[model samples]
Target: MKVYSYSFKEGDLIPTQYTCDGLDISPHISWSKVENAKSYAIIMDDPDAPIGTFTHWIVYDIPSNVLELKENFPKKSVVGNIMQGQNDFGKIGYGGPCPPRGKPHRYFFKVFALDVESLGLPAGLSREEVERFINKHTISSGFTYGLYKR
Candidate 1:
């Protein structure tokens, strides 16, 4: 499996519309359909954050049939049966890149194919909490990244 975006390519600079300086919406995300994938999960984080790794998005329990997520999704606990968790920004759903000015930070968009239909985890989980569930259930993973700065 592999994740890619129509808005930006790996290692490319993310658009301002997806940043705190702009619209603060999530860019479109798509991935190859993995065989035997019962469900899927997605997380986006900035390891270069000043306060350890900061999560921008935490979503799980996406039906296996979903291979793409549209941009500017609503901030809700559950949308179309997918469970969304809180990010380090203390909010639910996607919070776009917002780094201190000067250096650009790398934002990683990770996708996981799971062996189970659901993680059985609740929504509004922190990044760490979501990771705990992801660690045990992920069968395969792929990632793509983009750069951003204040």
Candidate 2:
């Protein structure tokens, strides 16, 4: 499995539309070639956050049949049974890159293939909580990174 974004290539600067300077929206993500996965989970984060690793998005319980996530996904806690957890911005769903005024930072868009159908966790979970579940149920993981700056 691999995580990728149509909005930006790995190691490239993410588009402004997906940053605080623009629409502040989540990038369009796509994954493929999953094997024996019953569900998928995604966590988009900026490890370079000034306050330590900051989570920008946490989505879980995605159906294994899913292949791609469209751009500008809803900021809802729950969308069609798929759950969106809170980010560092104190909101559910995505909070795009908003690094401080300095050099560029790396944002990781990580995807996990889980052995279970759902994490059995609730919405509005913190990144650490979601990560615990991801660790327990993950069978495989892949990621793509993008650079961003103010």
Candidate 3:
């Protein structure tokens, strides 16, 4: 599988509209379909965070037929069948990059093609919890990233 973003190219600087300095909304993201994939999950984080890897977004139980998540996705716990998990910021849905000034931080958006239609997890779970379930069912995965700085 291959993950990509229309908002920003791989290794490119993310626009301000998607960061804490701007609207702080989720950027539009898409991925290639994987054979035998029953569902998909996305985990976006900043490994350059001062507090270690910080999760910005967690989305799971996305229907396999769905290919992209639109920009500025709602901050609700549940949006249709997709479930949004809590980020390190203690908020649900996307939390745009807000890294401290100095070096730019890389924000990775990882997508997982899963064998199961759902992880059977509830909304508002932590990234660790969501990842644990994703790891067990993932059949294929890919990632794309963008850089940002305060």
What ranges in model 2 sit over 4 Å off? Answer: none
lDDT, candidate 2, 1-150, per-residue tens: 778888899999999989989998888999985789999999998888889999999999999998778999999999987899999899999998989999999999999999999999999999999899899999988999999877
Q: Rate the local accuracy (lDDT) of all candidates.
A: 0.93, 0.91, 0.95
- Give the top-scoring candidate (TM-score): 3
Q: Evaluate residue 98 in candidate 2 and report its C-alpha lDDT on the 0 to 100 scale.
A: 89
> Cα miss at 3, model 3 (Å)?
0.9
For every candidate in turn, the CA RMSD to the true structure comes to 0.8, 0.9, 0.6
Which residue runs does candidate 3 get wrong by more than 4 Å? none
Candidate 1 accuracy as lDDT = 0.93
Tens digits of lDDT, candidate 1, 35-146:
9999999999999998889999998999999998999878898997899999988999999999999899999999999989999988898888888888998889999999
Task: Tell me how far candidate 2 lies from the true structure as C-alpha RMSD in angstroms.
Answer: 0.9
Candidate ranking under lDDT, highest first, comes to: 3, 1, 2
Candidate 3 residue 90 Cα shift, in angstroms, is 0.4
lDDT comparison, 1 vs 2, better candidate:
1
lDDT of 3 by residue, 89-130 (tens): 899999999999999999999999999999999999999899
Q: Name the 10 consecutive residues with the lowest summed lDDT in model 1.
A: 125-134
Clashes of each: 0, 0, 0
Q: Using alpha carbons, what is the TM-score of model 1?
A: 0.97
Pitting candidate 2 against candidate 3, the one with the higher TM-score is 3
